[model samples]
Target: MTQSDFAAPSRYFVDESGTTGDLSRAGAGLDFKQQPVFALAAVGVDDEQGLADRLAQIRTRRFPQAAELKSSKGHATTTVVSELLDAIDALGGGILLEVMDKRFTLAATMINTLVMRPVSPDDHKPSALWFRMQLAEQLHDTAPVEVYDAFIQACRNPGEASLKAAFRAVLQLVPPETPRDSPAGAIRLFTLDSLKDYRKAGVSKPEVQRRFLPLPDLGHTGKEVWILPHLSAFTNLYARINKLRDGRLAEVHIVHDDQPYVAEILRSSKQAVEDLAADNKVMALARVDYRFVETGELTFTASTSSPGVQAADLIAGFAMRHTRDALAGSRPSLESLKVFHRLANTLDGAPGFGMNLMLSNRDVLRCGLLPSQVPPMQPS
Candidate 1:
């Protein structure tokens, strides 16, 4: 029953923090607020027995009565968290993490669906993506909060009426009274007109509608069509894993914590990535930073059965708490702060390979946490 009995596969254990429920409730005036941030953490390991043994030793000394390591338990204490970090470091493997702001995500989704659709010939240009990123951030930061609220409501029950309302909400944004030719005024006007055109052209047609709208996918019963944070983080992590092992002889597989509701979608999503990866030219033109490999499998298992998954849970929990507090402008205990710095030190060198903040540039600026604190945004 010991991990030492058999050689371990090249595996990365994964887990997440924060709820993935519908984000529209915050706007529905239902006294609901989803977790402001969502995060996924993956810890890669070449030695299962080494990780298992380290975890076992930690449990034996610090929490003899506990059956398993749960981040929610005392294992998140500064000392225990440090121990877990050390455990990961000892394995000489890499880490991948993703964090997002849910509100900013909704705003970005609305902009992508409404203003930037029908991929123009120019959209493939090198600067198009950067332009869009800036525009999305501007809209998210400056648009009336009602715009996002309405968009969220529409996504929950995407119909002609709701979609119309969402589109109209976007159109209501009035550009600042700046010089007519200024970048600020120009971009706003462009965004407004784009929304108008998209609405006039028919926002409900099948061609336009198939791109992740009509949320809470009734067809799949429990499935949702909106871009879930879990999917984005999961895919991003996979790319990083591939990058970590790009030229290596070993295969990389992921052992994820069981997520019954989203498991099927996760598999389908991975397959979809593989399909996309088949087109080398497209990926190259897009300047994708990583590639998907054919040698690995993504499978789900219970955390109770895998020490690696438990360790990931601990990492995820600490990240969630620390990030949530930092965003709220609250300080952590001295010990937690020390450990957080150490954690940041580990992430500093890896850039995108280690931890990533998926929030908009505007949100990043508003929070004022990244420049001197966390690692800078991944190199484009």
Candidate 2:
């Protein structure tokens, strides 16, 4: 057998930023918020040792004091991160990313989740009944209007239970080819919070028309059931990986920075992979074999322990800083955002699929870029 048959598969280094925006600081405009976006970034490489060594060289040279490297610092930090990015691309690694502008996440949804969470204050919070009543009132023109209205109000707050019910109410309105008998919580977690890449999830035109009501017409992206900003970023990255290399390798793996909420990440990713492998998701089938996700695995490591994970940390951190700058109307000069953008060219001789962006409608209209130029996944 050829060496290719036995060569170890590439390990994808993944990292994320802004999972929890400053909820206390959330206000009227996106610009003033401390955290305007959430980003998940990854780089794929076959030569794990080589890439790790190169990154160590840069770190040793730039941060000789054994000082920690952070992307939010000054020009010198940019130099370190930019060079590390260059090393990855030079070594034939592929990059993928997803960025979500969270300002578009509806206010009503965030309040609902906050109310349901365990640590919620015991008094003065709006009950689930009141929340549903408002949804029924506001979505009077949408498909769920009748369902929301007809559903009996709860005696008190539904807590986490409301999440499944809200998601179920929405999905039941759509005409499924087969009846959906699954539990509402299962349905919400499996589909809305799915981690499989969008490309692998088979969200093409045909499936969209088949699986969902006119959701966009309802004036929000199913926000009541899911907190989409960060989740979308993770899914988009997974999808992009499948898109670029469907048949080249036996498997793919991930090493990501440790996070407190790792369970959410792992759970969504597993479901995504499982859904892709299911018989009905045709576009997903085109992008990945069932074994790809079924057999694929991931491990989380602290960045200090794993250079690959550290590299991912720098990549995501640098990208998040750029986006935050963009929000505050602070322009990153040639030595900043420009360097990272240039590094991207080394991988595929283009901007590369390493970057995916989602922006609020306000930013979209203000940014001067055409809507067609931006990918459709970002919130409108």
- Using lDDT as the measure, which candidate wins? 1
**Model 1, 1-380: lDDT tens per residue?**
12223222368899998755545555343222536787788877778789999988988888889987788775766777788778877676556677767666665556556555425546534565455556566676677777776677667666677766776676567546755465446455765676566566677764444442433422136545555667766766666565545523146678999987677777876776666666542222221233454646889999999888888888888877776776667756777767756654454544334466667654444433353332212211
Give me the displacement of residue 162 in model 1, in angstroms: 2.3
In candidate 2, the residue pairs with backbone N, CA or C atoms under 3 Å apart (3 or more residues apart, or in different chains) clash, namely 197-239
Q: Each model's TM-score, in the order given?
A: 0.81, 0.58
The backbone clash count of each candidate, in order, is: 0, 1
The true-versus-predicted C-alpha distance at residue 83 of model 1, in Å, is 1.5
Candidate 2 — what's its lDDT? Answer: 0.48
| Candidate 2 minimal-lDDT segment of 10 residues | 210-219
lDDT minimum window of 10 residues, candidate 1 = 371-380
